[model samples]
Target: MHSRIGLFLSPVHETGQDPHLAVRRNLDLVEHADRLNFDEAWFGEHHTLGWGLVGAPETMIAAASQRTGQIKLAHGVVPLSGHHPFHVASRAVHLDHLSRGRYILGVGPGVPFDAKMFGLAPDVQRRRLDEALPTVLELVNGDSRITQKTDWYELQDAKLQLPRFNPHGIEVAMATSGTSSSSPRLVGKYGLSMTSFALPFALMTPGAPDHIGLAQQWKYAEESADEHGRTLRREDWRIALPVHVAETRAEAFADVREGYDRWLFEYFGKAAGREVISPDTPRERALEARVEAGGALVGSVEDVVQGIRRMQEATGGFGSLLVYVADWTSYEKTNRSLELLARYVSPQITGSAARPQEAVDWAVASRAAGR
Candidate 1:
């Protein structure tokens, strides 16, 4: 399993906060992450939720691409139901070309509130996604004429003016949960990668199980491949998590406590209409609950590493482990956490070559000289 770490661009609300400052801070993290040799930096989209400032991921990624080199930019998820197929295809293709093919287009039918924010009826989201996905796929694949008529949308002979630069185009991924039937089936049918949260609601629900969620998704992918008479490749599976790492278990928990709790409350509690609390639960129990129910990784470096290894063994080794590093935390701490993971944790898992001795020696010498 290739274990590359990616940072989710989490917007932070601070005391005396300016909205634009969050964007600047997030961009700063992207630049720092790129410099630290992180594989990818993902930007998420939301509307009416002060939780995130990047309502348009394409525009944000365009800015990020110019600011950094060698780090892939991903729209963690763009709500497919909110836009016309032509627009989504055109914009995604443009970002792909702009980033020189360093773009991963993640598409999903987002939360019901997001649909409501866009003046769209939540009931029609499935129909919209079903209608839009195929058309967008066809258009992005360089089709000049696409004619489709559906209950939610209709397109006739839609052709893209900008020539498709990426022959493979952007890799498509679906963000799904355990109980979502359409998303898993769509992922299989389209041969797209799958990324779903081990989220609270999905895990704690009576009918849904954590491992069962992953198993069902893989089952669909396998069936889809069998129907097409091809072996399913490893790169098609990704597991995303909220992770933090430090030298010791106590230090890791302490470092992440405030920010992690805030994130849980904001994202899971408030966003999902669940009861909010001060989170008196112990860190281990909280993490276990998330892991068993939703899939959060919060522990010491060794604990995190072991958990990832277990996940690989359990899931038959997925191709990617997308980590969330950004939240309501200091930029320096976030960078340090990423550096520790890259130096100590990822090397053992991914077999990436170690940093050269000369660079390490120079850093030590520079620090000694300064002292």
Candidate 2:
């Protein structure tokens, strides 16, 4: 099977831009991805940061499901720690039917800031997720009554009222940053897929790029899967990172420098309480560092191809590459970048296969139906 290329939209618009317009632009992006024949799109949920303003990714996914077809839709994640598993299962079933089995359930422990805002501590969120996830899985895939009582929530004799559209049941993925995270083991134990967030940062060790560190993470996942008598295939592994492909290296760097730097320092750095000033070093060297450690992709198509090959070599091989969404320049430029990736970068990695004609027909009819 060919490696898949996909998009992960945190939907981080320029701060203070009208929120309504930002959402419209995001919708436009998903539509464009569909037309470009991208494999999937993962929408994110965040409560606090303007950079990640979408609080209910399901609302967005439901809307996008109408406008496009063929691309799989994921929550990127739903913060299960704060939600009732019964409700999450119901919604997941409804969405699966609505999307005609195109939905992938991605669940994560709530973000620290969002969890605090909801009046829960970090450890509390972890505990909640542990209780909620299995309950959700049982509710979605099993017919038996599920009664569970936890300190934070309770589900008593809960069963999904709606039948799943996909007879095989929904696929699940957990987000994790590294091997040490309990998330890998937990997901592995359940035969769920794993999403490695921030591929560049995860590959880092002591201020340098370390592919060995990346392999070690995969090793942990493999071992965890084995211990639980579950199989985790390398092709089920997805690694996501920021990527922007322009006509030239200089052009790509210029397109992303300002917005990327602001995101690095203000959104991430401030959240972590550190100063991540852009280096006074030469532009090329600094840009290389950004790719190696910062997880930002800024270059031509050839550059992106080389980067993916390097990543594949590091991980031994994985299923998919998800491009992190960034409209640092403009929406038009962002759309153009996707076109470039689909046209040049993806074919280079996965081979040039024509977009299936049935997919094209399905998208056309779905767009015409407006649902």
Candidate 3:
């Protein structure tokens, strides 16, 4: 099956950038992706951080649906641990209606730091995820009255007053990063489409083959599926990672240099506590460390194509590639990076680039034959 090309906008704007524009640019990029024929764009929700400030992904998706023609829009994730399951279900179905079936619901156990501000214990999130998903899914699937009680939330015969836009039901994807997720069994129990984010240490170790446990993720899901007598389709499985491409490797690397340092210090360092390369390090050395991390696809368009191919094999194949939006480059250049992917990388991966090149080759061959 042909793979989808989508964007995952955690919407990582740096400290100095205007919050309004950061959010606006995310929509603009969605519009741009729509115009470019990209498959989908997923938005993140976060209230605590100065960066990634699009607090309500449903709102972003609703706004984006108006600007876009057909590109699929999704909540990159709604933090299940932090909100009532009914609220999640209602908003999800609402967005599904607003997008005319273009919306997908991706849910997770909430980011660790974001959970901190809500005063939710780290372990509570894991438990809440397992508890909340069933209720949320039940509500979204149809107006089935549910009665359930958990330490975090309670629902008594609750159902959606508003009917779901799609009778078939909304697509709910489970966002799992590394082993942080405690609900793979539940994931398979429900047969939710799996959306895997790049693990923080994915490429940190040399010779760390096996796609950062991509295959393992599916293995656990399939095992749990058998236990529940249901099959989770790999066609819905998605892997997301960082990407930035330009006309050349040098240009691509250069494009991300300025804001890259700040994003490291501010977002990754302060916010995430996962900064691999410090801004305090010597400039050249800091850059060298980044190049060594091997996490991002900061190279020519062709490089991205090849890198994704390797990832595809390592993951054993996936339905879509959602480019994790890290705005560590100029807005114009970031837009260009995506354009290059649409124009070059996509066709190359699908083997369509060769046909176009072959047509040109045929024209050149005739000229060489003195036609």
TM-score of every prediction relative to native? 0.85, 0.89, 0.89
lDDT of 2 by residue, 231-342 (tens): 8888888888888999998898888787776666567666545444344444335445667664666799998889888889877988898888865677777888899999
**What is the per-residue lDDT of model 3 for residues 230-322, given as tens digits with 9 covering 90 to 100?**
888877988777788999998888888777767766677677767454435565555335444435567898778877888788777887888
Residue 335 lDDT (model 2): 86
The whole-model lDDT of each prediction reads 0.72, 0.80, 0.79
Candidate with best lDDT = 2
Residue-level lDDT for 346 in candidate 2:
90
Candidate order by lDDT, decreasing, is 2, 3, 1
Q: Which lDDT value does model 2 have at 67?
A: 90
Give lDDT for model 3: 0.79
Pairs of residues at least 3 apart in sequence or in different chains that clash in candidate 2: none
Which stretch of 10 consecutive residues in model 1 shows the poorest summed lDDT? 200-209
In TM-score terms, candidate 2 sits at 0.89
- Cα lDDT tens digits, model 1, 39-103, are 78777787755566678878889999999988888887878898888888889889988888888
Q: Which stretches of candidate 2 lie over 4 Å from their true place?
A: 1-3, 199-207, 210-213, 275-287, 353-371
